[model samples]
Target: MKKSIVIFGSTGNLTYKKLLPAIDNLIRQKRLKKDDRVYLLARHDISLKQYIEDAKKQVKEMLDWTVLEEVLEFVYFHLNQIEDYQKLNHRLKDSGYTDNVFYLALPPKLFPEVAKGISASGLVTKGDASKRIVFEKPFGENLESARTINRELWRYFDESQIYRIDHYLGKEMIQNILVVRFANRIFGQTWNHNTIRNIVIIAKETEGVMSRGNYYDKIGALKDMLQSHLLQMAALIGMTRPKTFQSEDIKDAKVKVLNDLKLDSSSVVFGQYNGYLDENKIADDSQTETFIFAKAHFMNDKWRGTPIYFITGKKLDEKRSEIIINFKDDTNLNQIFSNAKPNNTKLVFKVAPEDGVKFQLNVKQPGLSDEIISGHLDYCHTCNWVGNTTEAYEKLLFDVLNNNKTLFTRWDEIEVMWEIISEIQHMNIPLHVYDDFDHLKEIILTEKGVDIDAL
Candidate 1:
């Protein structure tokens, strides 16, 4: 079957940098057939030639323009205009393209209008999963808003046909979490409250909001990072093994973990960067958080009483995203060797800047006077296969093409996620100001008693 991808906001950064490049990659991989069409819809009145030229300049990779030109079609779209969608429908039909995938790369506010226009214009038949809609994140401002968005989307498209994308879920390491946990006997056996001391999820950025100052100031790190990416990573790390690896089962497990998450006002720490106030489009007295460190725990039996820490920030540290699982230090070693202080065994999953796994074990030091030291079994996933690894967007776009919802978030998971965020928001946690990463780390240790080194 020939596939047609109708991308709204096609001239946006995401479309040029991610979506189009992903489509180009799919074509290169022979995953997208020759007949596959990419319909670029934008509010701007730009010709196909001009759009292609702009794309060539912005897209980082050397694109096969011949292939892209063959598949590409630019349509002048007015987002709220019903007549425009009707014309778009006609264009698709006239070009003999069906089995459409609508990628809405627009702002969250425009989702409902675009969804309504698509449905009303007869672009998609009711209850047809083949005609899917993809939604970008900042799903909604809060729980109530998320509910409203979900309700509005459900009015036009069935739950199965809606793909709510959280790009973090598409990363190779994130996908590998399932295999690392469920497939490995060693990790699987000890992945519980008994063996694990605490789990730390950290996503740090060295750069502040660049061009997205307006958007970042409004959403903040808590909503932008914790609510979606960090929480989703936590679910993947903490969720019980699913009955099957199917989309529904995987989502069910994730939803269960999300539902069990507990956060309090006292457990949350919000921080704004030193110069965030001076950022373009930011308010002088903006209370928005550039950093968030929250101590959370699961209420379920498997992970009950286990401390799970989520820490994310901008302009404070080197760019890194990782999950660290610290196992309980061996207490019995002290009884055998009076001078022994065994380091806690650690399993680290490095997510960004690099993709890798590191397991730290206490081993006897050489020239042993009965000395113990930490030995690492590190596997650099990216180092082994440098350029061959699939980009997150590429993997996600391919999944959309294949109608695989395994990597995409389910509505129920989003609901539970918002509920967690809402709980934190209602707590009225005071936002602090931090000078740098070291200061932020100090604040966390002082307030929450969570040592960054230990994590």
Candidate 2:
């Protein structure tokens, strides 16, 4: 079936940098039909040629202009104007396109208006699975607001027709988490509180909130990163194996983990980077936290007493996203080898900068000595193959096109995630100041008495 993709906020960074490149890659792969149309909708009018030129300047990759130009169209849209949506509907219907995808790249505030406009204009058939809408993260300011957004969306579209995208779920390594745990007997058997000492999920960025101070300040690292990406990652790591790998079953397992999550208020640490107040568009007295480190435990029997640490920050360290699972040291090893100390075995799922998996194992010394040392078994997913791997947005867009909801978040997941965030917000955790990752680590150690480095 031919599809028409209408992109709201077509002039934004996401559309230019990620969505456009993703669409171009999909075209190159022939995943999108030749008859398919991409309608770039913005508040102001811009020629298709100019839009492509601007996108080319922003997108670093060489786009397939020859193919892209054939399917691209531009539409002027006003979110508050019902007449514009009517025209859009007519344009889409006139072109014999009914399998529509409305990508709401606009801010969360405009989601309701767009939903209402689309519904009132009859652009989408309610309860129709063929027509879908996509929404980005920071879904709402809090739990109530998230519910409100969901209610407004449900007023027009069915839950099946809504795609609450968490692009992290589309990452190669993130998707690999399920296969690594469920497909492998070694990890599957021991993935519990008994064998695991601690699980730490870290996402650090060296750059500050450049150009995003306005957005970042409104919702700090906790809401922006922890509530969506980090929590979703934790759920993937902690959830019980799904009955089937289908979308609904996977979401059911993830929601179970989210329900079991209990945040440790005493262990929570929030910090703002030095000179954050001087950032562009930032208020002088902004108390927003650019960094957050919190420990949470699962209430379920499988993961009870196991501490899962969530850490994320901007302008702290090198850009990295990884999950580190530290296994409990075997006391029997010390008794067997009198000269050997217990080695803390760990498994790391490297998510960014490079996509790979690493396992820390205890190995005998090369010499005839009985000494044991730690060695790493590393597998790099992106080392030699630069262009082979699919980008997250490309995979997500493909899934949306094929009606695969496995990678997109469900509304239940969003609700539980917001509930967790609401709990943290009520904690009234004081915002501290820090220089970088090391400084933040020191503060955590001194204040919370938790050595994150060792974890």
Point to the candidate with the largest TM-score. 2
| Residue 272 in model 2: lDDT | 97
lDDT, candidates in the order shown: 0.88, 0.90
lDDT of 1 by residue, 325-400 (tens): 9888666867876655455588999998889899888777889467777789999887867466788999998889
Worst 10 residues of 1 by lDDT: 335-344
Candidate 1 lands at a TM-score of 0.96
Q: Top lDDT: which candidate number?
A: 2
Clashes of each: 0, 0
lDDT value for model 2: 0.90
Per-candidate TM-scores read 0.96, 0.97
Runs in model 2 lying further than 4 Å from the true structure: 338-343, 384-387
